[model samples]
Target: MQRRRLLPLLLAAALPLLGGPVAHAQAGRPIKLVVPYPPGGPLDAIARILAEKVQPTLGTVIVENRPGAGGNLGADAVAKAAPDGHSIVMGAVATHAINPWLYAKLPYDPVRDFAPITLVARVPNVLVLNVETADKLQIRSVADLVSYARKNPGRLNYGSGGNGSAGHLAGEMFKAQAKVSLVHIPYAGAAPAQLGLLGGQVDLNFDNLAAAAANIRAGKLKALAVTTAQRSAAMPELPTLAESGLPGLVVDTWFGLFAPARTPAESVQQLNAAFTAALNAPDVRERLAKFLAEPAPTSPAQFGDFVKAELAKYEKVVKASGVKLD
Candidate 1:
C-alpha cells in the first residue's frame, strides 16, 4: 500500500520533468508557408526568398500559393490550419491589413485569426506614368500629377493591381490628400497593369517599386514620386509624396508571416526567431534592398502591434476614401 502511494507521488513529482511530450524539441515536420497572391507577385517573391533562407533553419519550408479574392482564400486556409507551427501564411498588405476594410466580408479576421510572427519587409509603391502620357500631361512629380489631375478631373486615370490592393488604395489616398478627381482603374493583376501602362493604355500606375523600378530605369515608364515617407534607396533620385507637398502621406506595402490563432506561444517564438534570423542575414537584406524594400525583423509581439496599427490606419483610409469591393 505504501509503495503504491509513493509511486503515485513520484509520478506526480516527475510530471514536470516529462513536461508534455518534451516539446518535440526537434520536429522534422515540414512547415507550409502559404502565399495569398498569385505567383510572381511581390508577396510571392518575398515568400519564396524567405523560404529559401528559412528552410535551412527550420526543417523543410514548403511554399503553397492559394491566390483569390484579394488574398482572402489562403489567409482563411491558414487561419483554420492546425496551430502546430507546421503551417503559416505569408500575409501582406492586402490580406492582413487592407482587406479587413475593403471587403464586405472576409473569411478570417486579420487580428483574431492570426498569430503574427515577424514582418519580413516593406516595399514602397512607385508612382509611374507612361512615357508618352508623362510628356503630354507634363507630369514631372507628385505635385505635378496632383495639379494636372485637379485641372483635368476624371480625364486622368491610374491603374492598380486590383480593387482594394495597395496600389489602388495608394492612388485613392493620393487623390484624397491632394484633392484631385483622378479616376481609378483596377487590373486583374499587377502584370496586366504594368503592360497597360507600357502600352500607354493607362495614364499612370501606382505600381510596386520592384515591379516598376527596372522599367522606370529603362525609361519605358517615367517614375514620378515614391509613395513612402522617404526616398527609395533603389531610386534615390525620386522624391517622397509627402516631401513633394502633402505631409504625412506615407503608404508602404508590407509582408509578414503568421500562424493560426491558437498556435502555442513557444512555437510562435521559435518561428519568429527563425524569420528574424533570416531577415537579418546580410545577403537577404541586400537582396530585399535592391527591390526598394526595407528589411524589417520584428518580435512576434511587435509584429502583432504593427498589424493592429496597420489595420486601423487602412480602415480609416478605406472609410475616408469610401473604397469597397464585393
Candidate 2:
C-alpha cells in the first residue's frame, strides 16, 4: 500500500529526468525559445513567426532575447539548460561555426552541447558593387570582378561589418580562392558597409540580399552573385558565385533550432516535427519570403551533419584569416 502511494510521487519526480520538455509539456509549461540577438533582427522575427506557427502543436513557445557576447550568452544558456525540449535556441553560423574559432573561449561546444532540431532558414550573402564603381571599372560579373582584382591587385577594396564578420571572411575566402589582391575595409556594421560601397569609398561588398535589395532595385548597387550553394529563391535571377566561377565559394548566414544535448530522442523528434511542419506551411513560406529568408527544414540527423561540415569549413577559413576575438 505504501509503495502504491509513493508511486505517483516517484513518477512525478522521475518525469523530468525521464524527459525534459515532455514532462513540462504535460504540465502545461511553455517552451522557451532563446533568440541570441536583438529584438528587431531577422532571427527574432523568424522565431516569433515559427513560435506562432508551432503553437498549435507544441503549445506556447516563449521567445526570450538573451543577446550578448555575439550570441554566446543565449546559446550557452540553452546548452546548459536541462536536456529537455522546453528550452531551445535559434543558433546561427556565428554561434555554431565561426565563434569556435573567433572567440578564444566559447561557453559551450556547439556540436556536443546541443541537439539540433532543424535548420530554420538560410539568408544568402551577395556580392554587390556600387553602380557607378561597377560601370567605371567595367566589372559586371564575378569573372569581371576577379579579372579586375587580379590586374589591379590592391586597387579594389571590399567593405564588411567588422573583423571576422561574414562579409570579411567571405572576402578573404574569395581572395584566397581567386588568387586576387583586394584591400578589406571593415566598417561599424552592415549598414555602414553598404553606405561605404554606395558612396564608392569601397569597391564592393558582400551583404545580405534583403538588405541590399532596395539599393539594387533603385540601380544604386549592382549585384554580381550570391554566395550560396544554390541560387537563392529571393532572387533566382542572380547567379551564385559557385555558378559564376568559384565552385566552392558558398557562404550562408544561416540559423537553426537546437536543444540541450542528451535531450530525449522522442522529444527532439516531436520538436522537429512541429517546427518542420511550421516551416512547410504555405502561409509561413509566404511570410518568410517577404524577409528574403529561404526556409530549409531538415531532419535532426541531417542538420547535425550539416553543422559539423560548416564547423570544419569555417575552421580553415578562420585560421587562414588569423582573426580572433575575446
Candidate 3:
C-alpha cells in the first residue's frame, strides 16, 4: 500500500529528469495544426483558437501558417507528413475539393493523402446584388435575377474573386442550371470584386456570407439567397438558393481539420473528440460568430463522407465551367 503511494510520488519527482511535466503529456510531440492560408484570415484565427483550447488535452499544440498555391502548399505539407496525428491541417473546400480540379498537377490527392479529423465550420456564400443595381434592375429575389438574366442574355454580368473561385463557380452553376448567359467578370480578389459590385462595375456578385453580412444588414447590398444546404442562422430571414427555384445549387465555403492518411484510428478519434469539444465551447463559437462562421462539428466518418461528396460536386461544376489553373 505504501509502495503504491510512493510510486506516484517518485514518478512525479522523476518527471523533471524525464524533461519536465510535458513528458507525460497526451501527445509525444507538440501537435502541429497547419493553416493553409495566410495569417489574419478566419482559418488562421480558428486554428489559433482551437489550438489554445485543445492544448490541455493535446499538449502544446502549435498553429502554423503555410499559405500558397491557393492553399495547396500547406495541404501538401500536411499530406506528406508522418501519419502520427501530430501533424494536421486546417483545410478548406479549396484545398480538398476545388483545388484537385483547379490545378491539374496537384501534389497531394485530397482523398488518399489525408484522414479526416473533424469538420470545423462552414461559412455560406450568398448571392447579393448591389442595392442600387437591384432597384434599377427591379430584381428582388433569385427568381427575379434568373428571369431578368434569361430575358436579357449577356445584359447581366457578375463579379467574382477570380476565375475559379467559389463565387465564380456559384455563378457558373447558376448559369448552367438556370440556363442563363450572365457575363462573368473576375477581379483580383473578393474585396475588389465586391468593390466593383458596389461601383456597379458588375450588376451582382456571389460572396462569402460572412464577408457580405455587414453590407447586407446596412442595406448597401440586397441578399437574394444563401448558397448552403440550409438557411444560415446569421440571416435566418434569407432563404437558401435551393429554396429559390434551384435545388441543384448548393455551395458553401466549408473547412475542416485533417491528418495524414493512415494515422492511427485511436489518434484520429482522440483528435476528433478534442476538436469537437473545443468547437462546441461557447467562447469558441462566439469567436467564430464574430467572423460570421457557423460551427459545424462533425464526426470523422461524417467529415470524410462530406468531403467525398464535395469532391464529386466540385468536379462536376469545375469540368462544366472549364476553369483550370494548370
For model 1, the superposed segments whose C-alpha errors exceed 4 Å read 1-25
The 10-residue segment of model 3 with minimum total lDDT is 18-27
In the predicted model 2, the residue pairs found to clash are none
- Which residue pairs collide, candidate 3? none
Give residue 115's lDDT in candidate 1 (0 to 100).
Answer: 95
Candidate 2: minimum summed lDDT over ten consecutive residues — where? 16-25
lDDT of 2 by residue, 199-248 (tens): 98998999988799889888999999999999888788999898898989
Quote each prediction's TM-score. Answer: 0.88, 0.94, 0.92
Candidate 3 similarity to native, TM-score: 0.92
**lDDT, candidates in the order shown:** 0.84, 0.91, 0.89
Give a tens-digit lDDT track for model 1, residues 1-326.
89988997876566434422233324436789999877976667778888888766576788999988878999999999999888899888878889889889888999999999999888888888999998987888877887888887899888988777788888888888899888788888789989988998889988888888788888899987888888888788888887889888888888899999999887787788778988899998877776678988899999999999888889988887687888
Candidate number that wins on lDDT, 1 or 2: 2
For candidate 2, the per-residue lDDT at 268 reads: 94
